[model samples]
Target: MPRRTILIVEDERSLAEVLAYNLESEGHEVHVARDGRDGLSKARALLPDLIVLDLMLPVMDGLAVCRELRSDARTKGVRVLMLTAKGEEVDELVGFHMGADDYVTKPFKMKPLVARVRSLLRRPDAEEAEADKVSGAGLEVDRERHTATAGGEDLNLTPTEFRLLWTLMRQPGRPFSRHELMDASRGGDANALERTIDVHVRSLRQKLGDRAETVETVRGVGYRFNENAVAAD
Candidate 1:
């Protein structure tokens, strides 16, 4: 319920106005960008809490924007809610390795989109509450400061990936089920799909580089941080 900053990137003038109006009415400071390139610029400059990005854009596509943002250390952690032209586009975005936090199909209702925004904003609160430094092996995760690094390189993690890594790093060796991880990373969004956890884990691992092997998959169970290397220190 706190005031949040949100950015809306849509080429549709009417849709952008409606989104800005509704989000502002909810006590959120909202900004709008008419195209993908503009959105990327505003996003880096403003660093909003969440972004509602449309897939099809004029200057650059949404996926490229997402990639560019995720590649930047400053804007990588920002939460993104992708707006796609079709339901199937969601799969492409998720599986395409753009590292988007969440997705919504076009022709969506206002109320549900608002709820999604609220939910996305809440994703990091649980981690923030338990903020503390956890380090081992060649990796480090700082909750209070909200940073993660491996092998002396900054990991440009999204909000969900950061939460997921923190959850595992804080509790090494304990294999967490997909459902449990989904709840941890998503703040218990019951509508969230468990399969999405795999997608996130895959993306997280990809960013992890060499440390990727530390996040071991337990057959018939789930994933766990290899305590032997990163128990506590």
Candidate 2:
């Protein structure tokens, strides 16, 4: 495999060293930053292929770092994996909302962390990629660009929201159960609560405006995008 650069933003020096060592052993070039502000600066300058970010950091928090990275077009596409000692659903949600591509609680094994990083870097489904390349009614998804526009305006979405919209929009007529959507968008992590998907969907809908109706709720089933809606767009 090619040596991809990975930035590790962790306050714990010993833990950071261990992670950097393991990641380097896995053939990735690793860079370590002990605080969020410095991490953010390094991230912008280095533009690493991936970032392993801790939630709590000095000078700036991980959430802020994530937001800054996402807000900037240059670094928005860089994948992020949040590492934190906090295991609460809300904390995870906050990280996801701030643009984390994945969340792993601390006390995690290095192997799984590496696996998650690899998974995030892997190419998305070819079919989904094809579907997201164009616009649909009330929804316009551009997978390569990581953008979704509804009603001719860009929706300010977190990375997770963009992934969820891509998944649902690609299927169009297909109804995806919460579990299926979660798997498709959140890497099938059982630790990811169903409510997280719901929260993101609600946020997506709010930003979508008139296009919101296209995202149909199937009651007990889950949700589906309206095919006709995309055609109308």
Candidate 3:
């Protein structure tokens, strides 16, 4: 496997070193930043394959850093795995809305976190075999081209959002449970982080603009793309 680049933005000296060590052991080239401001700077320069962001960062804070990353075109698509001491669902949602691809609470085991990091680094092209192009509700995604556009305008989606949209649009009108979508987006075991799917969908819909209605939530079920549009030919 190619050595992927990763940036660790953590304030805790010991925690940061531990994360860096474990990731380095995985054969990844890892860089560490001690504060949010520094972290953002490294992220822009490195544009690393993935970022392990700490929620409670100094100088800027994780949400702000994530927001900045998502807004910057150069780093917009980079995957982010947020870590925080808070396990509250609301905190996770806040992080997700800021464009975190995955969330891990504090006191997390290094083994599982490493596994999740591996999953986050997996690109869409490396996922389960699927069609090259999918079009629906005026949105188009081309896996081979690594692009998602609405009316020819770039969606500028983070990696996670793109995967969720592709998973939904690939099979229009099929109700996918939150767990299924989670697995499809992150490429790992289905986790209880189903609610995070809602955050991604919300972000996706906002980017979809007027076409937001394309993704309909099924009560007690999950979400599905409206079959109203034709698949790309």
Name the candidate that leads on lDDT: 3
Off by over 4 Å in 1: 89-96, 125-233
Best by TM-score: 3
TM-score of each: 0.53, 0.53, 0.54
lDDT of 2 by residue, 1-233 (tens): 44566888999999998998888888775777799988987676455678999988999999999999999975888889999999999999988999999999979998888788888767463443443365678567876566677767788987667767776775577677776665445531337787788988899788777777778899898998885753465
Better of 2 and 3 by TM-score: 3
By summed lDDT, which 10 consecutive residues of candidate 1 come out lowest?
124-133
Per-residue alpha-carbon lDDT of candidate 3 for residues 95-212, written as tens digits (9 for 90 to 100): 8888999999988889999999988777564432334578876788986566999878899998778877877887778787776676556532224387888998999989988888
Model 2 residue 209 distance off true place after TM-score fit, in angstroms = 56
| Superposed Cα RMSD, model 2 | 15.4
Kindly report which residue pairs in candidate 2 clash with one another.
Answer: 136-230, 137-229, 137-230
Collision count for each candidate, in order:
0, 3, 0
Worst 10 residues of 2 by lDDT: 123-132
User: For model 3, what is the alpha-carbon lDDT of residue 64?
Assistant: 94
Cα lDDT of model 3 overall? 0.80
